[model samples]
Target: MLIAQVTDPHIKAEGRLAYRTVDTAANLARCVNHLLGLKRRPDCVLMTGDLTDFGRVEEYRLLRRLLAPLDVPTYVVPGNHDEREGFRRAFSDHGYLPREGDIRYAIDDYPLRMIALDTTVPGEPGGIMSDERLEWLDAKLRERPDTPTLLFMHHPPIVTGIEHMDVQNCANASAFGDLLERHRQVFQILCGHVHRPIQTLWRGVSVAIAPSASHYVALDLDPNPRREFYLEPPSVYLHYWNEGSLVTHLSFVGSFEGPYPFFDEQGNLID
Candidate 1:
């Protein structure tokens, strides 16, 4: 099975730009088209978080339109920029999304058990995994200890060395990490919110962060305090699972030159 992960689209109001700079809607449109045109389409699209710029109703409406071409199953979580009320209203019909309470839920649709975790703290840039949430997750992991489960959230539990971004990361990450240590069935943790594709090990499990559909966070790991992002080539993570193993690939979006063949009819060197 193949799963496509799209993150941080940050779509805004009609004709509006994100953060007064990036044309996020246009960027997401290109990404959507790329996913649609893929030679091997993804079984489902897992949008980690930050689906809109300000969690506005209008923005969510625009997002739905942008993702309309995709006929596969879709699952989403909320980031700091997303408002729970607005997201629920916008994506109410999404069966996985709960109409009330925390948006933490589970899906057993395919071979891999999926969990959409809500780590967003309302009205705050930083995220927190409350005690209730922690217990909920612990219970879920215990239920199907043998099933390979994938957890999705907005704020990553691990640090990325980007000081500014790290401040807004998951607050109770250490506790969350401890939980992972006990649950060997949790194969991977998927995250967003940094606007870049970052991979790291958290508590002995693999944590993969998907790149944004709009721009990338500047790859600066220095001590000088500053925040930056760039319009580098956009991309998403495509995960393939088979025989109890999962492999991920970075699929770059945007048009490209021909994928010319190299071998001749006789399977010999072309030149």
Candidate 2:
């Protein structure tokens, strides 16, 4: 099964640009087109978070229009930039999303069970896994202990070397780590808050952060680095589940060089 992970699109309202510079809408359109153009299309799309820049109704409306091109099932969780109420209202038609409360749910239809965790803290940049949310997650993990599971959320619980982004990572991650240690079925945690592609191991589970579809947070590791972003090449993470394991690939969006063969038609090395 192929699952395309697209995160932090940060779509804005019509005629608006994110941070007064990035054309998030156009970037996302290109991303959607890239996904559709993949030779082996994704079975589902997991939009980790930051679906909109301001989480406003108009932003959500435009986000929907941009993502409408994707025919596969797309699941989303709220990010720090997303307003829960606005997000709920925007995707109310999606039956998988709960009508009220935090945006959290589980999908068992695929070979790999997907558990989406809501780590967003209202009015705050950082995220947390409250006791209630932890308990709910524990219960969900227990329900399918034998299934290989993947947790998708907006905030990464690990600290990246980038100090600015690390400060806004998942708070109370120690407890969350303990919870995951108990659930051996969870093989991976997919996230998207850092705006850069990163991967690490926490609590014995592989955690990957997909890069933004627009601007990427600058990769500065200084003690007092300023919060900055760059108009880098947008990309997505394609997780392919095969032979009972998940292999992820970073697929950059936009046109590039040709797929030249390494060998000639006669199966000889090309000079």
Candidate 3:
């Protein structure tokens, strides 16, 4: 299976720039078109969140319009910037809220089961999974004990080594990790919200955080409040799962001027 993940577009109503900064919607559209133009199309496109900058009804409407060109199953979850009801009404038909009482869904599509979990906490920047949602996850895992499952969400369940973002991450990460520890079938966990591409391992499964389709969060190895990313070129992650192994690749859009390197099959230098 092939999946393209776009995160944290932070789209605005007027197609305006965010914080006098990035033109998120335009960047997102570029990434989408890049995916659409791929010779080997992805099976589906998964959006990890921050679909809108302020989570307004009009924002969602505009977002829906902007995303209409893609011809594949597009699944989305809410980020800190999203309103559950507003997001639902604009995109899905499941009563404008997650049918599972939480923004969680299971897509049963071959060798791997895709589970999208809602990590948005209303009025709060951080996220948490309630006891009820945890129970549901446990039950769902039990139902398909032997199936390989790939979990998706907005917040990374592990710390990203950045101070500010670390505080706003999933609060119940330990509990969530415990649940995954108990389920051997859960093979991968994919998330967003950090605005950078990151990878880690939690509970014996591969955990990946997709980069934003809009602005990037500067990768400062040191922890500092003054740190943030510039409006660098937007990017997306393409995940390929064959049999039970998962491989992820990053794709950047637009013109990039770099060193020219030409390689020969069995010869000397060609650059």
What TM value does model 2 have?
0.98
Candidate number achieving the greatest lDDT relative to the actual structure: 2
Better candidate number, 1 or 3, judged by TM-score: 1
* lDDT, model 3: 0.84
Residue 162 Cα positional deviation in candidate 2, in Å, after optimal superposition: 1.0
Candidates 2 and 3 compared: the better one by TM-score is 2
lDDT of 1 by residue, 1-271 (tens): 9999999999999999877899998999999999988889999999888899899899999999998988889998999889999998888889888889888899998989999999998989888887889999999988899999999999999889888999999998888888889999998999998888889877878999988888898988886647888999889999999899889899889878988879889998899
The reply for model 1, stretches above 4 Å from the true place, is none
lDDT of each residue in 6-56, candidate 2, tens digit only? 999999999999999999999999999999999999999999999998889
Candidate 2 global CA lDDT score: 0.94
Q: Which candidate, 1 or 3, has the higher lDDT?
A: 1
> In what order do the candidates fall by lDDT, top score first?
2, 1, 3
Model 1 is weakest, by summed lDDT over 10 consecutive residues, at 219-228
Q: Model-by-model lDDT, in order?
A: 0.90, 0.94, 0.84
At residue 26, give the lDDT of candidate 2: 97
Tell me the lDDT of model 3 at 65: 76
For every model in order, what is the number of clashing pairs? 0, 0, 1
The TM-score that candidate 3 achieves is: 0.92
